[model samples]
Target: MNKQHGSHEDKAERYELKQTLSTLQLWGIAVGLVISGEYFGWSYGWAAAGTLGFVITSLFVAAMYTTFIFSFTELTTSIPHAGGPFAYARRAFGPTGGYIAGAATLVEFVFAPPAIALAIGAYLNVQFPSLDPKHAALGAYLLFMGLNIIGVAIAATFELVVTVIAIFELMVFMGVVAPGFSIANFTKGGWSGQDVFSLGAIPGIFAAIPFAIWFFLAIEGVAMAAEEAKDPKRSIPIAYVTGILTLLVLAIGVMVFAGGSGDWTTLANINDPLPKAMKFIVGDNSGWLHMLVWLGLFGLIASFHGIILGYSRQIFALARSGYLPHYFAKVHPRFKTPHRAILAGGVIGIAAIFSDEMIKIGGQTLTANIVTMAVFGAILMYIVSMLALFKLRRAEPGMERSFQAPFYPYFPAFALFGALVCMGTMIYFNPLIAAIFAGVLMLGYVYFRLTRSQRETPPQNEVFEPSEELA
Candidate 1:
């Protein structure tokens, strides 16, 4: 009887992830993984759809993300798996759906880090004239990946500390830039060569959608740390809610301050938007400018390190569940970390950073294009995960749940509707890249179908129950 009731403990032990993360640490992971976006990537939206247009696009993305995060909290708390969206979709839709969710997650988590790594490189180059951006990026990948492989506790602690500093630096940045923030500067290019209601403006906002989404992109990655969290049922919800709120405020403040400090056009596509904006406000060689450039690296490093942690756990979960080769799932005996997964993700990210530099489409650099591709992956997972949530409500009505998504069908429906609009807009503006993303998903599905023999069949009726856990 006691063993039956202690299944949670058994599951925890067997899952292989060390549970050392508190709500604060989880919040750190959540915020740190996404802080870099407020520092960069998002400004590219201005290039696509001027200042006001991008701001409008961001409003839509913000709504989608807010609703999505709330609904997603239910899944994270109820399921509590490192696989995150993959685990939820797997339980709701079985192995095939699981693979699709996992693939989307893999794409989102894997591709995001390289984009941040590139930004890290850009920030370093601003501070160190001798450093090449690519070399700086490669060096960042090497250092952070090693740190992640060493241990999760140390990694999470580092994430918390850096995230706090990054948050503070952003506050300081806003204070310094506030005096230069003219409404005239912010509205200078509100529509960028197209009338507000023109068909051309439609595609402009569509093109800006990815960058808008960048503001809060990987905050959902908090759920990926669920398995490593202490008291996940309680901690996940707190972290998710707090993380989204933090990102929301930071996103609005950063965008408004940066755009108002200078011509939005000039700052639009740069990887170091904050430093550039600071230079506009405080002169090119001012101490404030230099300070921001250095502190800005912490924002990049926070996301770089946090996302590396997310992708490794994602890879580990997929491999352990037989979705990939078993070798990648092996946790380090001493550190209890997913060393193989971390290194594998690092190798892939480094290659992506190099490859993206060589590829360009319609005048957009590899970084911009890859950012779109990653958002495509995230939107796909969002759509699927929302559907999974609805399905599980019906399929597993009797299942225990620590958190239930408020506004139920309405909240999720709104999120789904927003995601679909975003996806359609993405496909409209970048059909070829969208097609390629679809092709990748199709290939993933086919591969999983053919390799069904390799995957171990999980228990039939208890798919949502954490296997090998205490009751």
Candidate 2:
């Protein structure tokens, strides 16, 4: 009787999330997590670099993601922790490195959603001019946070449906805009600031990296779902490879069509670039225009909802490991989701919505400001993660590996260098935002030092083993 009672207590303490997600659903989460990037943020590249310059920039950024995802797959499958990069870095670099990786990841997952939420609001305002974007943004937060807290199965299912619709809409968008595609139009002002072959054009290409990165910004978010994935060893590789390819196709298609359709400048900075691009291709009165506007919301919703799942898991992992307040680690006994973490993140996102409205820098809106800020965080995390991969490869050579990155050192080294270059270029271009990001990292480190150590020894409540493996 006592043994059974102890076993029940152990299970409760584990906070073990049910592994209900299959490969298709994992693919949905991975793709949905980043599909919104195709719709909005990448256009900003045109502002920094002309149409051709942006395309050039995107090719390099694509290379980085391709290599990084391959290397990340090995660590994620072997470690298979909800902490994602935090877990991998922790294993590689001790507490300080782990904290940096975790903090950057928090910034990436947490900061990403507000931008998507704001885009959702912008899409709504297009339909109903009277509605305030902020109100719609806040409403989305509340509704989705509740859904996330309810259950991962339900939330993931919703993600799958919306992701499918969003993919279809992009296809329809490409079809509508295809005939209008003009090589001359696409190539207009293709090089901005300097000639392509000149040394001076390097800055323009580097500056455009962030916008190009928007195309695949959160694709690595697939790693965050490792804990919930049904057959992580098998499903993760398939999802990562397929997800990046899908985004690559979508990214190139959208950038070319939108760039060529009109004065790319017109849509360069707006949140609803696709709808505006539709206006240029088919004119304003086309029936497809209205449908695209409404359907575009699904793309933003897919990302916003998907990231909520990611941030909550990050929070749960940190809290469970004692890097954060224990409160955030608590799972809802009924739903078995991290209810506290979800609500806490929602509150932060709501605050970010209002803060963006109140703050502006160098004539850039709060939305642009935060998007760059999130990129700052993401690159920092990427630098650490790629290094961790190399470090672990040398340090623990015999670690069990279900999947290995194709190229040993070169792939990860290139990814690491590219991430560093992007970070340096962004800092040179946006010093103030870089300063703010640096301050946040410093403060996060200070807090980590003061916190109790969960790294030295595993907590009794933590479960290091999977509850069940895929057959």
Candidate 3:
């Protein structure tokens, strides 16, 4: 009788874990994770950062990304729950901090889909010429929703396949563009204000800093797949770090080879930057330009797919814990994917089309404001997560850890500091932009507090006691 009861408990636990994620699926989450941050939206307004600024921003952000991936992997493995940052904060900090962490992630995950889908529209306009950016953006998002509704397995497969194509394209661009690279093109001063302290190009480096941090963003999707991974401990860390490393290499290569030395004349007209660089280096007839555009489009498509794939999981996770609407927790019976939440993501994308594509502020983008808002929101979440990590180590020393953030206080501290600097630069150069960013986060907090007060009780009966893992 005792043996049978123990077996049943094991089976129940297995079933719950099975619903989380598998290794391959986690890989999909990993690749899809960065679409909004850089891979999807890379072209939009980066030039405003200028060439030297852009290259500097890209390299600096890549380092930050690698460090954070390490941090997240450590936290994810320890928590083993669906509510990623929430679980980490709860473990490291107290429940209140956990709620705030969850709140910030909610903002990032919620806002990200639209931010990405909006980007897809911008590029599609260049491709089709006749296509409206808004329509193209909406069409792409609808397709992503459809695929996600079909299944995660399919979605993961798509993410893997597209990431492969993107990786190859980046490699080809480096291999071809390396020969023509001009060293002088990269260092040219941009948008000058001689005051070395200013944020224009120098200061812009700080303000535009967030623009450069693209490597392996969507990889947070791995956390969403926590229930789906075959061996959550081993698989998540391997895929998480490896995928981030691969992206970092590609990002750096593009910076070196594609964005390398060129005359301001050649660089000035370079709107479709990467594709134009490849064509410039290899002659368009090599059929490489077509391939570059296609690959970029595919990567962009993959990014949107990832947005739906990754963020819906957040909804599923929050819902399962009773922190969000239970409908978000529902997985399709036939597909085993979160169809309801997948559609819910559409709300933000559609809103972006209305707000940015439709309305303009001073003949400039509400879109630009949206982009800055996302960066601030993501940074806020990063801040909460890092502090939570420090707290987690103090409380959860007894918990089994699959991965540890390297250099102890070094990497996490620097990453948090970098995140702060990035945010400050962004706010300083673009306060109207920054205000929009801070406003969104404040709104979320206000909403959460109001909702919590009205409910009168916490979401779940579960009590999360602190572990001994504090630093």
Candidate 4:
């Protein structure tokens, strides 16, 4: 029995997949990343606000991300493994800074799910007034969180359904809007949002860039599903390229298409703009078409599913690394999912329900402070990773590369340039809010350095063999 126990442990190790995913899964995972939970609103908000100029501005911003994705694809194809930016930073910065880079990302992954879950609750409340939106959000967050705990395959399958709904809705939208698109509407207010784009326009733009650039924020999926990709090298590159391009086309297309069809004043104010646009194009004949508008509804569900998967993996990685409790790293015996991490994400989300504050900002709507916090964290991680990528290129010039970032210094240079722009924009738009987020990251960084223990994350090469033979 003792021998059997040891054997079982070793077998678990065999299946541990410290590094296991394939390329196909990686690509699907990449696609899954961009169709993030918060996007349904993000894009709609960008469109309807009629900042037609701003929407176009946003499309330009979205286009700018191509450079970053290509650069990442180049890296993913070459490096093509998990730990993502954390993996990259670790290699470039060594233990100290690497750990720091990854820790910063933890802030992003950790906060994303709750932000999204909360958003779901808000939308539900909007649809059905009496539902205690917060309660609906709580229940919804818990249900999907449970789905994520099942395993990535299940999550991916569920998420694929959501992505399909979202994309189909968008595609239908494009088809409907294209014929109705009047170039006159687009050019009429081509320069309308001029007020918001003043002397502070550049700064404001930079601050907003973080919010817009990677509307998908799918980079987390690279690391989370790294272990499951079929051919991470070839598959990831294709998926990375396809996913980014697809989103870029679909995302930019819809809003730009919508802006051409109508003005910001008209489009922006409607509750569900995309669906509303469909209604405008198809009319009541679209009661069936309205069903398609429910794509955002399906999207909300999918976004919930995907974020849970990404966050759970981050938790699993953290737990395995010693940054979090060990139990969180546990893989389900049969499911092979990070059951503990799933639970942690769920509990935190549930706990957040208690703190849901309805703040009146963009015209009397209830938004979670936690959502903004998540954005701050994601930006911080990217900043550190940018520096890491820069240093790595210089410090370890000889590191093998199957896929070097195109245009050499220029390609990643573009990403670094663009990333900075976006970060600056996010901050400019929300001064007090951005400051609080920065403070939290600073606090987390300090806490980690102060608490060095056996709990410290061990490297991939380290053995878990402590007293194993003795036992």
| Top lDDT hit | 1
lDDT of 2: 0.85
Task: Quote each prediction's TM-score.
Answer: 0.94, 0.95, 0.84, 0.83
Q: What's the ranking of the predictions by TM-score, best on top?
A: 2, 1, 3, 4
The parts of candidate 3 lying over 4 Å away from their true place are 1-25, 35-49, 190-201, 261-272, 279-286, 357-367, 453-471
Candidate 4 residue-wise lDDT, 1-471, digit = tens: 999999877755633543444544555556665664323445333432333435545665565566676666654554543456665665566556646656666666666666566556555654566877568777887788778766666667666666776677667668876887877766564444445456433333343444454365655466556556666666666767777777767666765676666654465433345555555566656564546535566655655666677777766665565555667767787677777777887887677666545333344223324555566666566666667767877876886666666776776677677667666766766676677667775786675566456244332223223432110
Tens-digit lDDT track of model 1 for 256-275:
98889987788887888899
Model 2 per-residue lDDT tens digits across residues 168-238: 99999989988888888777767864677776666677787778888888878778788888899999999
Candidate 3, 210-310: lDDT as tens digits: 45643344456577677566688898898887778766766666655655635433433222456656666666566766676666666666667876776
As for TM-score, the candidate ahead, 3 or 4, is 3
lDDT of 3: 0.64
Clashing residue pairs found in predicted model 1: 6-470, 7-469, 7-470, 7-471, 8-469, 8-470, 11-469
lDDT of each: 0.87, 0.85, 0.64, 0.59
Checking candidate 2 for backbone clashes, the offending pairs are none
- lDDT rank order: 1, 2, 3, 4
**Ten-residue region with minimum lDDT total, candidate 2:** 462-471
